[model samples]
Target chain A: MQFLLAFVIGGIICAIGQLFIDLTRSSVTPAHVLVGYVTAGAILSALGLYQPLVNIAGAGATIPLSGFGHSLAQGAIKAVQTRGLLGAFAGGAEATAAGIVAAVVFGYAAAVLFNPRS
Target chain B: MTQSQGQGNLQQQKMQQELQQEYKQLVKNVKPRPPVLKNTILAFLVGGAICLIGQLILWFLKKEGLGDKEAAAATAAIMIFLGALLTGLGIYDVIGKYGGAGSMVPITGFANSIVAPAMEFKREGFVFGVGARLFTVAGPVLVYGFLVSTVVGLIYYLIR
Candidate 1:
């Protein structure tokens, strides 16, 4: 049931993007959509609305760019509670550091190994 | 003389219209049509598969005694690793070409976005090229992501 929820929710999010791609006149780029999702996630999470969806949907809620936003908000809020104002600056970065570091390190290694196609 | 000049201008306008029509036809013949339906299905299937893999990893982490939060983090890391590795091998681009948003909608796509530009700019040298372009796609995401979170945190702190 959890897996089903994850699949359905995750598939719907991607489908919305697909629909935009299929129907639109190519006005919106994928990066814009991704950033929009992340921003929405952050806002929803800050308003305390995203947690329930994450609770129910699991990876469906967490794997999308919005989930990245949720993580940033959650980290900031948690840090603010414990560390005060300083947490706002450090918290989001600390929380997302794993994903960011992985991207940079792996990206650099991949850059070394592969030649880009023109 | 005035009447002849008007006639000459009308003839030039007709020739211009014909040239425009010919150019439109030439472009129509050269433009390639993408396989939209196939791409949509591939995106749906591949995007779903990547999420399913993330879910499976989360489940495994939980079984190994990690709490939900810890498991979530671990799953994200593993997915990023896989995404980067696949991108390094040039496999993800094929998947990206076919899957479109399917491959991109997930965190794995984020990894690919970072790796792809870095690989492309590597020829420009490491510091100026790979290091600089590493965040081409993700830089905006991080900047805005952190900025918004900080504001939200401040607001939450003030209110509560």
Candidate 2:
């Protein structure tokens, strides 16, 4: 049941992205959808809306790029409470540091080791 | 003779415009429309499948006694690794072709965005090519995600 909910919720979010691509005739690329989702997710998280979704959907809510935004907002909000204004500048990146660093390290390795095909 | 020449030029311009318009109509009629419904279904299924995998990882981590936050972070790292590995293997592109946003919306897609361009630009050397182009697709995501989250944090601070 948890997995099913996650699948449905996550799938819906991605389907929305697909709709944006098709309706825009590819003018709105995948990168645009990703950026937009993150921004929207942060705004929604700030508004105290995304958490409930996360509670219900678990990884389904948190796995999408929007969930990444949610974590950033959640981190900043947590930081502000504990560390004051200084946390605002650092918390967002700190929370996501693991993912970003992993991507960079693994991405660099992949680039060095593999060749791209046409 | 000058007046006739001006009239002839006007006639020529009109004929050219008419030909262009006809060609546009023909091209429009021949171009096939995208399969919107099909793509949406594939995106939904593929995106959902990826998230299900994430959820399973999260569950496994929980069973191993990790807290929620730690597990989520580890899940993301693992997913990113999988994405990069698949991209290196040239399989992620196949998934992207079929899954579209479904494949691209997950963290794996983020990895693909970084790795695909990095691999493509390898001939230009690491610093100028791989390093520089690595974030071409994902750079905006990080820039805006942090910027907006900071603003949201500021607002929260002021409000409370």
Candidate 3:
């Protein structure tokens, strides 16, 4: 059941992105969509709305770019609660550090080891 | 004679407009339309499949006794690693071509964005090529995501 929900929700979110790309003739590139989704996720999360979706969808909600935003927002909120305003500066990056660091390390290794095909 | 010349100019303008419209129609007819419905279905299936994999990873970690948040973070890292590895193997692009936004919307896609550019720009050398170009696609995501989250955090702090 959890897997099913995750797949469905994740697919729907991706489909929305595909539809936006197709309908706009891709005037909005994939980069824009990715960045936009994260921003939207952060805003939605800040409003305390995205958490319920996260609760329902589990990895489905969290695996997408928006989940990253939720992590950032949630991290900040948690930090603010415990450490005061100073937490706001450090918390968002702290929450997402694992993902970001993994991407950088793995990404650099991949680039060094592999060549792009034309 | 002046009045006649003005009338001819208007006629010429009308003819140009008609020609331009005809060319537009011709181009519209020539261009093949994208398979929107088919693409959307593929995107959904592919995207969902990726998420399902993530969910499985999350579940396995939880079963191993990691807390929920910790499991989630580890899952994301593992997924990113897979994404980078697949991208290096040249498999992810094939998946991306077929999956489109389905692949792009996931965290794996984010990893692909970072690696693809870095690999492509490798000929220019590591410092300027791989290093600088690595974030061409993903830089905005990190910047804006962090910026907005901080603003939200500040707001929450002020409000609560």
Best by lDDT: 3
Top candidate, metric TM-score: 3
Model 1 lDDT, residue A77, Cα: 93
Docking class of 2: high
- Candidate 1's C-alpha runs over 4 A off are A25-27, B1-41
Q: Model 2: per-residue lDDT, tens digit, B36-91?
A: 99999999999999999999999999999999899999999999999999999999
lDDT of 2 by residue, A22-112 (tens): 8785478767988998999999999899999899888888889999999999999999999999989888999999999998999999988
- Computed on C-alphas against the true complex, the DockQ of each candidate is 0.57, 0.80, 0.83
TM-score of every candidate relative to the true structure = 0.83, 0.90, 0.91
Q: Model 3, A1-118: lDDT tens per residue?
A: 9999999999998998889898885478778989988998999999889999888889898999989999999999999999999989899999999999998999999999998775
Candidates ranked by DockQ: 3, 2, 1
* Docking quality level of the chain pair in candidate 1: medium
In angstroms, give how far residue B144 of model 3 lies from its true place: 0.7
- lDDT value for candidate 3? 0.93
Model 3: runs farther than 4 Å from truth?
A: B1-26
DockQ of 1: 0.57
Q: How accurately is candidate 2 docked according to DockQ?
A: 0.80
Determine which window of 10 residues in candidate 1 chain A has minimal summed lDDT: A22-31
lDDT of candidate 3 over B34-138, digit per residue (tens): 899999999999999999999999999999999988999999999999999999999999999999999999999999999999999999999999998889877
TM-score of chain B of each: 0.76, 0.83, 0.84
